[model samples]
Structure formats: C-alpha cells, structure tokens
Target: MATISSTWRVFLLIILSLCPITLSATVVEDLKNLHPPPHFNSTILSNCLKNPSLRYCSSSPMMDFDEIFKFTIVASHLCNESKNPTCVETFPNVDLKNRPNIAPLYLSFDFFWKYCPLSIMSIDLSNNSMKGGFPTDVLYCTQIQSLDLSINAFSGDLPIQSFSPLTNLTFLNLSYNFFSEIKLSDSQFFKRFNSSSFLHSGALLDEKKFTLKAVILLVGFPILVILVVVCWVWLCFQRPDFLPRKLQRTRRFTPAILKAATAGFSNNNLVGMSDVVHIYKGILRDGTEVKIEMYWDDIPRDSYRRFVEECKVLSRLHHKNLVRVLGWCRSRKFRAIITEWTEEENVEMWLSRSGPSWNHRLKVLKGVVECMRYLQEEWPEVNYELKTNTILLSDYMEPLISRFKVGDQTSNRKKIYRFGVFLLEMIQNKKGQEEFDRSYGEFIKYITTLDPADLHKMIDHRMEVTETNFHQVKQVLSLGFMCIDQSNNERPSLATIFNIIARAYKVSLVLPSTNHRIFHGERFKGHMPVQIK
Candidate 1:
C-alpha cells in the first residue's frame, strides 16, 4: 500500500509539471483567436509568452525558450478574458496584405490595453513609421506612466481632453510628428509638457490670421530697416575700423564688442561675481545673448593659466549637461570666456523656491553624475568645481553642470568625496544648504552621525516620500556616506557609484570592466585592484 501511494504521488507531480504547458498553449490559442488577432508566429508567441514585458523579445533566433511556456501561462492568467474584452474594440483590423511580415507582437499593445490596462505602465511606439492622427485611444489606458509617439507621421491637433483623465501620465513625447494645430498655451493639462515635446511638429504653430499687428509690422518694417541701414552706413564711415573688425570676426568677439554688449560692464548687467572672475549678461550686435566670464586683474598667474586650460577644455567638450562655450577673449588688459546665455536660475535658487519633486531631483542628480563620469573617462586629469551654485537649471528644469575650474593635483577619490558632499546638500534640503555654508569637515561629521531613521528629516518636506521610493532615497544616502568615507580605499570608484545609483533608480548603466593589467619590461602586474562591481 505504501509503494502504491508513493508511485501515485510521483504521477501527480508529473501531471502538475505539465499543467503550465497545457495552460500556455490554451492562452496562445485564445490570443490567436481574438478579433484583429495578434497574428504571432510560434516563435514570437513563445517569446511574448515567456516575457510579457517583451524585454527579452528580439529579432534574432536561437533565443532562450525555457521561460517562454512558463511566462505564457502567467500572462494568460493575468489576461483572463472573463474580466475584460479579448481585444480592444478601438483598434482597427490590421492590413496583413499590405504588410505581411508585420510581427504579431507589435499588436501586443492591443492585448495589453484590453486585458491588463492596469499593468500597462509605458508605451513606446517611436520610430515605427506610425501614420495618421494621434492614437487617442491610448490615453484610455489610465495607468500608463510614459507615452512615446515620436518620429511618426501623426497629424492633427493632440486631443487635449483625452489627457485630462491620464493622471498617471508623467512623460508624453510627441516630437517629430506632422501635428497641424495644437494650442497648449492655456491648457493646464498640457502645461506639464515642455516645448521639446512638440518640436519638429506642425502643431507648434497654428495658422495665424493677419491682424492689425501684422499690418503695422508690414507698414513699419521697411522704415525701420532703412533707419538701421542708415545708422550702419554712418557708423561704417565714422568708425571704419570698428565696423570692419566686428564684421570680419563673427566667430571671435573682441573685448571692445563684449564691453559694448554688456553695456560697458555696467553693474546692472552683472549676473554673478567670484573672487577670480565676474560674470556679465551680454547681447551682441547680432542679437545673440551670451554670458561673459571676465577674470580680475588681481588673479594670480597660476589662476590665469588655469583659466586658459579651462577654455581649451570647454572649447572641445560638448555634452548636453555642460554649458556651451561660444568664444573667448584673451589679451594684455582683458581675459574672458563667453558662453551661451541662460536666464534660468541655478540649483541653489531653485531649491530655495519650494524645491522640486523627488523625480526632478533624481534627474538632476543623474545628470550631474553622468557629467562627472564623462569627465573622468574622457579627461581624468581635469576636475569639476561642482556645487549647487555651479549647477544651473535649463528652461525644462534640466540640470546643467558648470564652472570647470582647475584643481590642485588630487586623487580621483577626493573628487568623488566632494561630489558626495554636493549630493548630500541636494538631498538634505534647507539643513543641507545651511551645512553647505558651514565648513566641509563639519558637514561630513554631521552626515556620518545621521541615523537612517532621521534621513526623512534631511529630505525636502515639499517632496513626498512613499514606501515605493523609500528604498531608493535610502540607497542614495547610503551611497553618499560610502562616497564620503574618510579612508580612500573604503570609497567606491565612480563607475561603482554610478552603477549603484543607477540600479537603485532602476536605470541600466553599462560600465567598462575595472580589472586591467600593467606590464613594465619583464615585470608584469596581472591585475590592478579596483573597487567596482
């Protein structure tokens, strides 16, 4: 009787093992039968079933199929037809005849919306040759967090009403579309998006009917042009060298031109001033606004050399987060670096004004880290003068790292420590700012003693912290502490720091292997020690 029972138990286990396979096959069939069917081939269906997120799905064959059956069964259970429609009724029947090679997986959006709208968090249909007007039906998926419809032939005005219901939609991309007319100026719903969201789209500007303003411009434009030309001709004759020199060097602006642009370095034009340099807001003859960083005469010779080195670096360095170097002027009496002007406030000013959301703050942190990583990888010799004051915000609230001052020869670990201080200041809100005003040693001492439970006290009260993001916040604090460790060997490498932070935020970052070999003559070191994972 015992032997028979044991045999029966084994039989039951075998049946249970096959149950998932049976369920997956059934789900795949059901998915195939839905109206405007997913039309997935065995391979695509298998891939989709395994990873409903479609993260592992690729064009290549010889793919891993071990999880395919298992995932299909899970997806099938999640997409039970009894709860919702088998397919979204809104999506039209795909024209298989026109595009026979089209993958059934492409229609996964349909299945996702119909069966698991709540699970649908992001939709990226960018650069897919998608045509016709914006797919307003997508907005019906209320749980969607991000929507990318860029690089498509989508036309007509964006349905603003549809967005009103999408409270969870934080990211909306409509760039490189043929949208004809979209008036988002007054719409509170559309205010969340930046100008870049609607860039390279016809909807940027609607057809404007000629009005009294247009007529006034038409009548007064020629007179204005004539007066400008007359003044230019008078200036050219009176000060021939002045006008010629300005015209000849369009790329490089002279000190005299920069002086005039900044209203002869008027006090009103002064935007910022440091011990070594003064920053002035200026507008050139061509109506291009620029920031001029002028060095003080009292600046030491070493500081002057550092400025020149910085100019050389800035002229070559081109990153979205770094300020753009327009031109520079170096002479006996004058030394200045001109860059593209931005009217937006710095991180310090922005923080003072109620601060930003956790998401924006994280973005700023990420940008600063990326800039640091780039500098480390490209020019390990150069170090950034990173601080809240040095970091400016763009119109879209993107963080721009500025002020690349030459530093005394220091280990990369020390630079990382400084970055940690900066990051801590960013996270700690008002207290951090006050700490920043105090000595670095004091800030380090205070932070080291801070209890994990008291981290909330350090964070900005304006930003909400929930259980979902509590781990991420803590991770950042932990990273800051690790980075600011007194023992250089205890500190993590920039790559390791970046990886940890990226993983905490659920962002993917590929870093080069830290292990390397060095050979000198017959002697060779098999591997250099590196604290990076």
Candidate 2:
C-alpha cells in the first residue's frame, strides 16, 4: 500500500507540469476567435460619406487646406468601419505629418488602435501636441516597419521592452519629450536608434550625472562667496591706511546751522582772509570750536567747483601735521569748508613776539619738512599755498599746517623754494612778506656775495648761541640755500630736505661751500637792522 501511494504522488506532479501549456493553447484559440480574418462589406469612401462626423466629411470640416486635402486622400484609402475594414489588409501607410490638431478631444484612439490594420507598416504623427505615455495599443499593429512620433509632449518611462516584440519595426522617432527614463532592457530597438531618437527625453542623463550637478550648485556657490570675502579682508589688512582714504565718508552741514555757528558771519568772527575765501572762528551747537572758510560770492561758478575739489582732497587726508576737515556746508548763495580750530597763534605772529632757541626752531622745521614730503610723494594734489602765516605753532611748539589752497597751482620746486625762504625768516627772526612777493631775488643776490666770516651779521642776536650750535646753524643755512636754487633741477627734493632737518643739531650736513655766504655787506656794515615786531 505504501509503494502504490508514492507512485500516485509522482503521477500527480507530472500532470501539474502540463497544465500551463494546455491553458496557453486555450488562450491562443480565444484570441483567434476574438479577431477573425479581415473582410470588407463596404468601400472606404462609402463609409466616410455615410458618416457625416467622420474625418474628411463635410460635416467635420478642417480649417487647414493641406490637412483637408490630406484627409481626403486618407479617407479614400483607409476605411473608418467599426470591424473588418477593407484597408486593414490592403493599406500599408498613413502620412499625418505636420498636423498640429490631428488628435481631437472626442475621437477615441483606443477604438482606432483596436482595429488598426496589421498590414499598416508606416505612420508619421510628428510635430503634433499629442501627449501621454507610450501608446500601448500601438503594439496591435505588429507589421509596422516605420513610425515617427517626434516633436510631441509625450512623457514617463519609455517601455523599450514592449517595443522589442515589434521585430519588424526598422525606423522609429521618439524625440523631444519629457520622459524620465528608459524602462527595462537596453534592447536591439535602442541599438538601432541613437540618442537623437530620445533627445531631451531624459534618457541620456544618468542618475550619477544629475546628482553631481546638484552637489556643485548647492556647495560650490557658498564657497565662491566666501573666497571673495576673504580676498577683500586680506586686502584691507595689507593696506589699512589706504583703504579708509579710498572709501572716506563726507559730512554735510545745512546752511542755517553754519550761519548760526558763525554768528551770521560778522567781521567780529572773522579770523583771516585768502585770495578766494574768508576764514571765520565759529562755535557749533555741540560747543565745538571750528574754523569755517567761506568762499567770496563774486564768482559763483568758480567757487562751487573749487569747493568740491577742496572737499575731495581734505576728506582723504589723515596726518598729524595736516589740518583735519570737520565737514562742509553748501547752497546757491555760499559754500564753506569747516575745519578743526587750533588755539595757538600762527608762526608769523609767534616769531615776531619772542626769540625761540635753535633747538625749538629745528623741531618745528622737522615737522614742516615731514609734512612737505608727505604731500609731495603721497598726495601731490594738495598744491599748498605754503606761507609762514599759514603754519601754526601748538602749545608744545609742534607745527600744524593749515588747509590746502583749493585752486593753487604751486609746483614741487616752488614749495622747496618757499621752505628755503621760511628757513631764512626763522634765522633772521622776521616775517618774509617781501620774500614771498618778489621771490627774494635781491636777498639771494646780496647773500651770494658776502664772505663766510661775516655770517654772524645775519644771525638773530636775541637767540643765545654757542660755538657748537653756530657750526650746526651754518650747515642748516647751506642746506636751505641748496633748496632755493634758481634751476628747478638743482632744487633739493623734500625727502633730501627732510633727512637734513630730522638730524638737525645732531649730525653735521656738508653742503656746497659756495652756499655759506651771509647777509653782511655795505648795507649792514656798522650794525644790524632793529628786529621787526
């Protein structure tokens, strides 16, 4: 009984293996019955004429002339019957290229593909707006040899595996769509067609390529911004002094505020005058004392331009010896430059009152020389109208030069010559008003002829001088003479002048011996002129 039971189990397993084959054959038979051999009961034209709503019928008219003519040709060959259409086995081609409105809303594509002729080999539906996934019903037309569906709005994964069954399909076009990927295998269909068949259909772009682009945009953008900021900070540290001047901020004052500060700009508030502007002492609302320079109202256009130029130069300056610009006030009536006010008197007034020692004078000279070098090399645009009257002495006797002349055309050589004249005035204990006006032509000529032994006649007697200081003073005078040379090329640069003064009374500077002449001659043979007050 056990052997019989085992044998029956073996027989059941063998029978189960043959069940699928039997069922497949039954399915094939049912399909053959569903779609029988094609036959024709009426012609292609008679069906289109009987149905007024059929394509190319007068009731369903088309606007495009080419499309209308094309439909007429198609209706004569391709039948519109529900079942067993005559053209199903006769017709082989359907050309619908450049038909934008080919697919109508009411038309049923499923019914059309269901009865599509197996003999139909080629179709051209390119350049249309028909949008959707790959047409599953199109597989029913198994005998298709060529197909064109390019330039449409089709999307989703292309079922390349499904097209693998259409072995006879030789030519195909599926370009210009929004498909995300190519589905299933990289079959012979893809091998027959290049990337142009799926242009912009997302089939060429792999997952890794897309991911790399996303990472570069998300991470690299911030890194680029950070690099730019780091470079700007590095530049700022490299040139701290230069950066501020390039981006200096200017302050603007209202006309009423300036007028009130200067007490209506009366003569009592006036401190000094220049060829273009009048200087006035003013107290601000914050109790800050400032010197205001108001341009004369006679030449409005010229004054406006000068005001702008001066403000540009002043805003950039940042040196101890140079004057600080406070702000500016402007209007149609007048324009003014507001600057920090110094308490001490100018060099001209200070010298006429008392005799300062050589050491004290040397200190002031060093300060002036440093400032001149700065202006010459660093900011030649200053163009100072340098004068003893414009140089002020502070409480500690440190020199503070005044604002630059707005439109002065003073050259570098002229500045060196002015310094020489200024040096002589300090030595003589007198102002050089005559020297400034006439360039001291007579004085230079007279001193050039005097003997070196007579140098004492030109010294300020009020100064308590010793033998050691006298030799140092002689060297300083020689350096000054070198600066005021008649030839522009012969004039010493501000740098050379600064070096001599910086080491004044410490290092002996050897200059031309011909420059050692003094002011003593027939005019001052007996005694010196009384010190000018």
Candidate 3:
C-alpha cells in the first residue's frame, strides 16, 4: 500500500509538470502599465515596434506581413502583416510587388550591422522595437528601395554617408526617430519632392520654392502688422514698457556685433542641431571663444522676440552645471544668442569617439542630475531639454546643460511633461530631440503615474545589472517619472525629489554607461575625454 501511494505521488508530479503554464500578461501589457509608451510598429503596422518610452536593447524577427490577418503576435514572437491597411502611409504596397525577388530580411538596430550590412532591399524597420542610430553600414545595402524607420529610438545625425548610398531609396521615412537633420553634403541632397523621405516634411521641400512662397506672404502681408511690431519694439526699448519685464538689466549685443563675431554670417560658423538651434564657435578680438546659436527662422519676426525672452531668462540663471548666456543680438537681417564655449564637446560627439566609456556616462549623469536639481530649485519655469548632445562634459567630465530659454510659467506642467521624454532617450540610449519630444508626450499621457518599477524599465540598458548601478539608478529614474506627471499636483516637488535621490543614491551613485566602457571579464575600464587626458 505504501509503495502504491508513493507511485501515485510521483504520477501526480509528472502530470503537474506536463500541464501548460499560463501567463497573466505579455510585454505589450507590461508596457501599457507604465507612462504611455511610444506607439511602436505604428501599433497599427510594424510588428517590431519598440516602446517609445524605453530603448529596447536588441531587435529580433517579427511576424510575417501576411500573418496580420490573424492575431498580431505569433508564437510569442513578432511578425509583420504586410497586407495590413495601415502600411500604405509609410511604404506603398507597390514596392512589395516590384521587388518580388528580394526575400524578407530581418533588420535589427543592434545586430543587422554584422549580418546584413547592405544587401537588404525593401526592408521595413518602421515603428519597430529598434534602439541605436541609423545603421550607416546599411547604407552599404545600396539596393534597399523602401526604408521606414519611423517611431523607434534611433538617435544622432543619420549619417549623410548612410543615406547617400541609397540611390534607389524612394520611400525613406525616418519620422519619429531622434534624428536632428538630413545634412546636405555637396555630393548628396535629394532634390526630388517625391523622395518623401525625411525628418520633418518641411525639411524636404525645395528651400528656394519655400522661400519664394514665404517672401510672397511676408511681402504680401499688410504693413500694419509690421507697424505694430515696430511700435512694440519701440515700447520695448523705452524704460517703462506696457508689460512688466522680468529681466534684470544685463549687457546685450546688437545684431551687427553678432555678425562681426560670426565673420559676416559665414557658413563655416554653422554648427548642427538634432532638434534645437544650430551652434557656431565664435572668437572675439581678445581671442575669447563664445558659443553662438541662431534660431532658424527670422522672417516671421515674432520668433526673434521669443528668442530674446529666452535669452534674458537664461542670462539670469547662474549655475556651474548650466551654460551661461552672455547675451543676444538682434539685427534686421540676422539674430544670434551667445553663451559660454566648452572644449569638452557635446555628448553625441564624445560617444561617437572610440572611448566614451560608461564611466564617462555616469560622470555625465551626475553632472546632469546636479543641473536638474539646480533647474528645479534655482531657475523658474526651467525646461530640461536633456539630449545626449545638450549634456556637455566640462573640462573635468562634469555635464553642463546648455541652451536655456525662458518659457511661460503657466506652461510648466506641459514643459515638465518633457521629463518623461528625457527618460525615454536615456533608456533607448538615443541622443536626439525629436525622439525626446515624442516620448515626452507619451510619458505625459501614459507612463508618468504608473508604479515606479514600471518607470524603472525606462532606464538605459547599457548599464550592468548591479545593485548600486543599474538597479538603484532605475529607482532614481522613477523620481524623474514622478517629476513629469501630467498633473502638476501629481508631480513630486523638487524638495521631495532631492530627498528621495539623497536616500536612494549615495554621493558616489553616478557611474558612466557609454560605449567607451571596455569589458575585461567581469571588470570594465573607463575612458576619459580626449580633451582631458
């Protein structure tokens, strides 16, 4: 009887082991629980769509496009349903019919560079869970005709070389990636309007045509609008103006002075921007270096006033971790803002280097947090436009936040909504503005109020899984999540954030997490900036 009972127990155990296990939720449900993450794969289209709020570390095969007629998920794997109605917006189905011989390719943002460098034709990486930059090496796939990389976490300038190689690319929509510009090197600039491929559609139009239309409007608009602006300017110059100016009088530069500083508007001074204004390196007579940036549009004129206001606010902010706005210049044909120049380089360029180590990332993060604390406390209505490029390493690897402009205090709730945006970029290891802004919007709506651990998932994956490192840093990321709550009432006050950071992270909490970290078995060596050592 005892033997029979033991045998029955064994049989029950076998039965239990053979039974299928049930899962309460999948990654999609997991993502939905947090700050509204980005709509990946168009949610309506690509199966590989990555979370806008998080930078998924790697990419994998998605479902076949033909499989969308059934459920979207296939065997717990991602598959594309090419026949879906929504795909018409990005890639016209015509490309699929024309390229019949081109077999389906798996283009992951991480591993695609190694396995499929350039042969991929008619591939769609759109709205998928891709992290990292536009695979410049994919440019080698000179045959790729239709490429849709929209709404993923691709950061940095899409290599001019990468796009330059795709002579056959008819449908190139990089929308929603953290790309700043489609630079026009003398060899590349597509003139055809049908190229339909771009960051913002406005960038793709013939500049000359757009300028003609803009001039026609400007020249066509009634002079009364100009008169009102002139009157507004006169009132601004007067000691007592109608609106109370929050500005404490400081040294201001005129437009001519700025032109002289920039060598008479030379193209040599044109820096770059992934989202904000372009920066130029300027040298004064005494040989002092001043960083100069011009807001792109000057014709509308109201933009100039807004820039002036932004500069005034920045001038008042005095912080070691924040860039110091020296002043701004307003000229009839030109406008410019001046600030402190750094030799340490922007985060993007540094990361592009052979050695922007994880140590550097951590060091930069500490400086960024310091700047954040200052902005939350010292600056009023501060907008944390935290991008990899905006976070500059000072001579000592201290991250200095550049480009402060004043925004409406009443709009702080909307502005703070960008905090989730910053967290999104950090998670994806993306370093551009567009992705930052989209994710910002996503978090404001969906992710900010979720339980903090859900928010923690947005931390950069490059960091190792250590208690004091990635884990605790994620706890701090939750604080960022708190600060960006849509309801200002729901947001954590700066004091509360400070107290929380103080408790969760030690004085030595920050450690770099850039590509420069060299792994040696279990240990990693940190690399300093070229300017440093």
Return the TM-score for each candidate structure: 0.45, 0.45, 0.39
Mind giving the per-residue lDDT tens digits that candidate 3 earns over 333-371? 556678878874877666555344334454555556667
Worst 10 residues of 2 by lDDT: 34-43
Query: How do the candidates rank by TM-score, highest first?
Result: 1, 2, 3
* Cα shift from native, residue 35, model 3 (Å): 99
lDDT of model 3, residue 388: 68
Candidate 1 residue-wise lDDT, 187-243, digit = tens:
886688887887787666543533565766998898899999998876553323257
How many clashes in each candidate?
1, 0, 37
lDDT of 2 by residue, 367-443 (tens): 88888888777777776655677888777788888847555668777888889878876776243235445456776
Candidate 1: pairs in clash = 49-72
The TM-score between candidate 1 and the true structure equals 0.45
- Residue 209 shift from truth in candidate 2, angstroms: 70
Cα deviation at 301, candidate 1, in Å, is: 8.4
